[model samples]
Target chain A: MASDQKVLELNDLNVHYFTPRGAVIAVNHVNLYVKKGEIVGLVGESGCGKTTVAMSTLQMVSAPGRIVGGEIKIEGQNIVNLPEKELRKLRWSKLALIPQGAMNSLNPVTKIKEQMADGITAHEKISGAALRDKVLKLLNDVGLPERVYNMFPHELSGGMKQRVCIAMAVALNPAVIIADEPTSALDVIVQRVVAQTLLDVKNRLGVSMIMIGHDMGLLAQMVDRVAVMYAGNLVEVGPVGSIFEHPYHPYTQLLIDAIPSTKQKKPLKVTEGLTHDLRNPPPGCCFQFRCPFVRDACRQKPPEFKQMEPDHFVACVQYN
Target chain B: MGGLTRGYFIQRLLMFFLTIWIGVSLTFAIPRLSGSDPTTAMLLTMMNARGYVENADKIIAAYKESFGLNDPIGIQYIRYLWNVIHFDYGFSFAKFPAAAWSLVTPALPWTLGLLTVASVLSFIFGVTVGSLMGWRKTPRWLNNILPVSLTFTSIPYFMFGILLISIVAFKLHWLPATGGYSRDVNPGWNAPFIKDVLAHAIMPLISIVITSMGGWALGMRGLMIGVNNEDYFLLAQAKGLSPARVFFRYGIRNAILPALTAFALGIGSLIGGSILVEYIFAYPGTGYTLYRAIQEQDYTVIQTITNLIIIITATGVLILDLLYPLIDPRITYKKSVAS
Candidate 1:
C-alpha cells in the first residue's frame, strides 16, 4: 500500500438498493484500493455486491439504488459528491468501464465506428475525419481488423464484440478502467486471448484496472492482487500469490480449493450450501452460515476486517 | 434480395385475396342468417296494417328484382366479388345518386387526417413521459400525474368525443360542430377549403388525443421499466453516459420496439375505431358514411365499404410486417437468414 502508487481508493463504502420489501444493503463497509499499473480482482459469486461496487465507483447505479456511505477517491479527487456534469467530464477522460455482456453493449442499429465516436464525443469536441482516424487506431490497437468499423453489432461474433467493448473503454486513455467479467461469455481460447489482450493493453498504456470476475483461476492469471468477496463482504484481500498459496479466510481457502487441477485425478471440491441471501444476512459474519468452522462467538457480532500480515487482510474472528 | 422481396410480395397478395373472400362471405351470410328478410317483413307489416295486400306484393317483387335477391348465394357472392375487384360499386340506396365508394371516399381523408395525426402525437408524448418516469427509479412529483393520465385512457372514446364536442363545439363555439368543411366553400384542393376541413377536425382530434394518449404513456412506461432492467442499459450507464442519453437512446430505443408493434396494429384497425368518433363529430369520414348506409339497409354500399376496409387493413398489416426487418435486423422473414 504505497501512498504514491495508489490510483484509486475506496473507504468504508456501503451501497443499498431500496426494494418494495425494504432496503437491502448490497455492499457493506467495504474498503479497498488499486495502485497504478495493477489489476485488483474483485472475486465473488453472483449477488455478492461485486458488480454493485464496480457500478458505484462510476456513479452508474440506477433508481432505488444509492451509495449510502463511502468515499471514492480517484487520483486524490473524491468523486462521490462531484456533480453529474463535473463527474461526466472525468469519465472516459479519467475513468472508464468495460461492462458485462459484450453482445448487447453496442447499439445494434449503429456501426462499431459510430459507437466509438459516441464515446469520444461524450468528453471531447472532435468529429468527422479526425474522429474516424482516432476510431480506426483504437480498433487496430485492440487487435481488431479495420473492417470492423463498418460492421453493425449483430454482424460481429461474441469475442469480437468483447474486443470492441474493450476498444471503446480504452478509447479515451483513462487512468483507471473497470472491467466487469470481461471474459465470462467467451470460449476458453477466446478467454485466454482476451485476458492476454487486457494485460497487453495495460502494459502498452500503463493504465490501472479493477477486474471483477468469479473465476479465481482466471483472476490468478490476469490480476496482480485478488479480493475475495462472500455475501456482501470482502472475506480476504492480498497479493494473488499470497491469497492463492496461503489463504487465511476459510471462504478464500474454499474458493482456491474449488479450482480444478490438471495433476489431481480426483474431482474438484465443491462448497456446500447456497450463497446467503442478502435480504436477511446472518447476525454476525455474512458467511457464518456457510463456513465449516462457525462457532458461538461467530454469531454474536460481525468480525471487523483485520490485517493478518503486512499486505494480507481477512474479515473472520477465526483469524484472531 | 430480389428473391426475398418477390416472396414477400407474393405472400402479401395471397393474404389480401383471403381477407376479401372472408369479408364478402361474412357480409352475405350475416344478413341472411339474421333470419328475417327486411323487404318481406316490411311488406307483411304493411299488409297487416290494412294497406293494400296486392300493392304490397307488387312492391316486394320489384324490390327483390332490383336487388337480384332471387339469385343463388354463390352467384350473388361472385357478382359482389367481381364488382369489388372492378371498383364499380353501384349507386348507394341511402344516397340514391352517389356511388358507394364516392360517398365513402370523401370522408376517408378527413378521418385519416384527424386520427393519424392525433394518434402519432399522443404516442410520441406518451413515450417521452413514460421513458423519463421509468428511467428515474424513484417516485417523483411527475409520477403522481400518471393516474390522471390513466383515467383519461380508461374513458371510452365516444363519451370523450361527446364531452369535447359539447364543451368546445357547442358551449365555447370554438370549432365547427359537423361536416368536414363549410358549405360556403367548394370542396376543392385549396387553402380555404383545407382550413375549413381542419377547423371541422378539431373536436375529433381532441377526443382522440385525450382518450388514446394515456395507453401509450402506460405502455411506454411499462416497456421502459423492463428495458431499464436489461444489462446493456446498466452497461451504458457504467460507461458514464448521461442519464438523458442513456434513458432516451438506450432505454427508449429498446422499450419503443414493443410500442411500435402496437402502432402497427393500430394502423391496421384505424378505420374500425374511427366509426364512433366520426359519427359523433359529423366529420363526414368513412365511418359516418358507412353508418348511414347501414341504417338505410343499403346492402350494396355496405358490402363495398366492408371490402374496402378489409383491403386497406390487409395492406397496412403487410406494410407493418415489412417494416419490422428495417427497424430491427434481428427479425428476419426466414429462420435460415442471419439477422
Candidate 2:
C-alpha cells in the first residue's frame, strides 16, 4: 500500500505483561497494515493476543502490560512516542475504539447524552444545544431515537446498548475505529444486525477499521483482509478470500477446517495436542506441537514470515 | 421524566416518615415495656448508693405525679410523640429535674462539631488516597497505604481513644485531657473560646478520625479496584480522557456511589455521638449526657436521646435517597422491570 493510502500500520509490535512469576509475551513482533476505508479482521482464539493488538493500536493497555517495543502509526504519523497530551487530542477524533461487551461498556450511572457529550466535549468546546444536536445525529445514524438520550444503560435493551456504543465510537467521525468483538455479546439474530450496522457505519463514514473477533465465518463475510494469530504470533495474513480459500499456514488451514459446514455433516477437524504454556513458550513454531507436518527445523527454531503468494504472508517452514 | 422523578420523591418521602415513626414508637415502647416505674427506679438507685431509705414512698408518689408516670400507657405514648414533634421532652428525672431538651441541645453542637467535622475530613482524605492507591498504574509504594490503613482500623475505637489520651494528655501533657472547652473561659463565639474548644476536641477527633478513616479508605479502595476492572473504565481510558479525568470521572465517580450509604450512616452516628469516646474524654457531648442519664435512671432523657438518634439517622437516609437521582442516572422511581 502507498504511504498516504495506509491509515494504520503496526511494525515490529511487541507487547508483554509482567506478572510475579515472569513476563508473558502477549503480542510478539507482528506487522499489519490497513488501507483507508478497508476493514481488516484480527482473528484468534481467546488469549491469542488479538485483543492486545487492538488495545495497543490506541496505546490503551493497562498496568503491567506495556508495549515494550513497537511503532503504531496513524496517517503517516507515528503515535508510539506521542506524549499523552497529544495522544488525547488524536483519540476519538483521529482514532476511536468500540470495546467488547457493549452491555457493560457504558457507564451505568451515566445517561446516553452525557456519555456522548463526554467524548465530544473532551476534544471540542461543544455543549448544550450544539452537543445535543451532535449526539442526536450520531444516535440517529446508529438507528437510535432521541428518546434514548435521557435513558440510562439499564433502561436499554442489549442491542440498543450496542448501537449506543457504536454511536459513541463514531461520534467524532474518526478516521480509524478499532472494534473489539463488536457483535460477540449479542445473540445470533442480534449479532447479524449489529454486524450489519458496523459495516454500514464503516461504509457510510468511510473509516478504516480493525475488527477483533474469534469467529472466522463472521469475519470472512465482513472484512477485506484477515490476519490469523496463534499463541501471540501472527501465523498468516492475506486477503479474506485467499485466507478462506488457500490459507498458507497449517494453523490457519486447521482454523478454517474447524468451521462447521451446513450443506453436509462431517466429523469436526480438531487440532492435535494442547497449546503451549505462554509462561514457557516453545522456541520454535508455536504450532509445531499441533501441526501434522511438523519438521525437525520447525521444532528447533521459529520460522520467519515469508510471502507465499501475492499479498499472502504465512509463517511456516513449508512456505519458506 | 419529571413525573417519574416526582413519583420517586413522594415514594421516598413516605418511606422516610414511616421509618422515623416506627423507630420513635419502638424507642418509646422499649422503656415502658421494661415494666419498672422511672420514679421507683430512681429512688431505688439513690437508696442503694446511699444505704438508706427515708420517706421513699412520699418521694415515689411525688415523682409519679411530677413525671406523669401514672398516665395510661397508650395516652403516655401519644403525649410522648406529641412532645417529640415539638422537640419538647418535659423534665429529666435522672439529673436534678432539668428540661430534657436542654440536656440534648447543649451537647448537640459539641458532638456535631467534633465527630461530624472529623468524619467528613477523614472521608475526603481517605477517598482521595484510597482511589489513588487503587488505580492500576499507581506506583508500588502507594500499595503500602492499604496495610497501614488496615492496621489503624484493627485497633478498637475505645482502645485507640485511651492510648491517645494517655500518651498525648497524661504522658506529654501537650493537650487538655477532658471537657468540650476550658471551664476557665466562659463559652462564647470569641476566638479564644473557639481555640480552647478545638484543643479539647483534638484527642477525641484524632481517635475517631484515625480509627474510622481506615474503614472508609478500605471500603473505597475495594470499590475502586472493582470499578477499575469494569469495561466502562477501559472505554473511558480508550476515549483518551485525561488521566485525571479518567481517574476521577470514571473510576472514582462510580466507586463512590456504594460508599454514600456508609457516609450517611457515619453522619448519623456522629450526630448521635460515639458513646465510649465521649465517656472516656468526658467531652460534655450527647453521648456523655446519655451515659449519665443511664446511670441515674433518667427515662425522659433516655427516651428523648434515643428518639433523636433514630430521627437523625432516618433523616440522613431520606436526604441521601432523595439525592440519589442527581448523583446516578441509573436510579429512577419508574418501573424499570418492563425492559
Q: What is the TM-score of chain B alone in each candidate?
A: 0.83, 0.91
- Where does candidate 1 clash, by residue pair? none
| RMSD to true structure for each model, in Å | 3.8, 2.9
DockQ of the candidate models in sequence: 0.40, 0.63
Ten contiguous residues minimizing lDDT sum, candidate 2 chain A: A265-274
- In order, what lDDT does every prediction score? 0.80, 0.85
Please give, for residues A132-168, the per-residue lDDT of candidate 1 as tens digits: 9999998898899998988778778888888888888
TM-score of chain B of 1: 0.83
Task: For residue B279, give model 2's deviation from the true position in Å.
Answer: 2.7
lDDT tens string, model 2, B142-173? 77655566577789888998999899999999
- Interface C-alpha RMSD after superposing true interface residues, each candidate, one decimal: 2.9, 1.7
Off by over 4 Å in 2: A1-4, A125-129, A295-297, B1-4, B35-37, B54-72, B137-175, B336-339
The CAPRI classification for model 1 reads as acceptable
Question: Residue A107 lDDT in model 1?
Answer: 75
